[model samples]
Target: MVGKRQSRREAVSEHKRELILDAARQIFAEEGLDGASLRAIAVRAGYTPAALYFHFESKEAMYAEVLHASLESLGSAVDQAVSRTKTPQQKLKAAALSFFQFYAANPRDLDLGFYLFRGGMKPAGLGHDRDVRLNAALEAALRPIAEAAIALGAPQERANLLMVDCFAHAAGLLLLLHTGRIRMFGASAPDLMEAYVDERIAQLVQE
Candidate 1:
């Protein structure tokens, strides 16, 4: 009976941790990192501040969790999209489009992932590993696309460089658009990203 009770308690604890994370995501999206406080997050999570600290040591820790979870989800989406395409060019385009679509669907997540650096929320520990793995996965997804483009009569080095450059540019552009720092084609951010990817892919294929 004691063992069963302990297992149930652990499950409850895990559920509360998830609740805190969900609440933190909502609070961070609504208030930004600097503006969101531990007290506010606790209230949002239906817990006392001390209860929140039981799961996360600090506001920074909670923020890190939110960012880590968001990025992991996005990375998985990119991986799935790339795996579905057979050709390198198609893979590249799919990866690009998948990334932009993620941001369009989760602007708050995009803001949390990319723009938080400017807000003084430096990620540490596992957060760093998450970022590195995410970037490497993206690069790996593009490699086949670059190789296929080269095999089809395109210049090898240029195709590889351009593919990396285009992916980086798209990520930066999404960040800028989300932060209201740039406008594109006078359309919604999603439309602008789609148009940009279309133009970029066309230029690459023609070259």
Candidate 2:
């Protein structure tokens, strides 16, 4: 009975932690990291500021967790898209499209990923260690695209370079989309992305 009660308490604690992280994602999207405060997150999560300390060491910790989850979710979507297609060319296209669609569909997530709404200068990340970890997550999410390129007969260096290009293009398009600038170009981000992917695939494979 004691063990059962302890397990129940742990489950409740975990639920609270998730709530905190959910609130953090939304708030971070709206305010960015420097603009967001522990009090704000705790208030949004319906807890006292002190209550947050029980679950997280600091706001940076929560930001890292939120970003990690966001990147992992993106990686999963890309992986699933890759799996759904048969040929390497198709897989490469699917991976890039999935990356764009993930951010385009969830503008809040894109904001969170880019740390939007900062009023002043912002470092690339919380610090060196956090940046390394976060970049690794970002890299893992984009790795399958390079892997698909390699499958299509591109050398490792070229495939990796192409993957970086895809990331740059996708992220730039997504930024234009969120800022309502894509309409000025008279082309949908998806259409532009498809054209880009089709050209890249053609360059690599004879199909």
Candidate 3:
């Protein structure tokens, strides 16, 4: 009976942790990192501030947790997108397009995963672990495109560089779209992304 009770308590603890994380993600997405408050997050999670402190000692800790989880989910989405294509070239294009589409459609995810609360706030212990995991998740998301480039006759070093370049290109376009600069130039975000993927695929194939 004691063992069962302990298991139940652990389960509840984990559930509460997830709830906190979910609430934080939503709040961070809506408000950005600088604007989100711990009190707001606790309220959204339906937990008191004291209860939240029991799980995450600080706002930075909670942000790190949410960022790590977001990156993991993003990595999975990219991998699944790459898996749908059979050819190396198709894989490369699909991977890039998937990444572009995912970020474009989910601006909040782009902000949290790539932009918010990541610099200057050094987390100790578990925060360090989360950083390590975030880097691994980022690499996983990019590896498929790099691997596909290698299979298409490019050297591994150059292929990896090419992947970075591709990401930079897509990311730049997305940034412009997000900031409404793309609209100023009378360009459509989706059209630009499609064109970028086609051009990039051709460049990779020709190299």
After the best TM-score superposition of candidate 2, give how far the Cα of residue 21 lies from its true spot, in angstroms.
Answer: 1.2
1-207: candidate 3 lDDT, tens digit per residue: 999999999999999999999999889888767678999999999999889988998887898888777777778888999888899989988888888888898888788766423444453333567667777777788788889988989898988897788778878898899999998899988788888778877887787
Q: Deviation in angstroms for 177 in model 3?
A: 1.6
Q: Where does model 1 exceed 4 Å of error?
A: 120-164, 175-207
Candidates ranked by lDDT: 2, 3, 1
**At residue 79, what lDDT does model 1 achieve?**
79
Once fitted onto the true fold, the runs of candidate 2 whose alpha carbons sit more than 4 angstroms away are: 116-122
Better of 2 and 3 by TM-score: 2
Candidate with top lDDT is 2
Candidate 3 local Cα displacement, residue 64, angstroms = 1.7
RMSD in angstroms between candidate 3 and the native structure over all alpha carbons: 3.1
Where does candidate 2 clash, by residue pair? none
Which runs of model 3 end up more than 4 angstroms from their true locations? 116-129
Better of 1 and 3 by lDDT: 3
**Candidate 2 C-alpha error for residue 46, in Å:** 1.9
Window of ten residues with lowest summed lDDT in model 3: 116-125
lDDT of 1 by residue, 126-158 (tens): 356555655565465456546655654668787
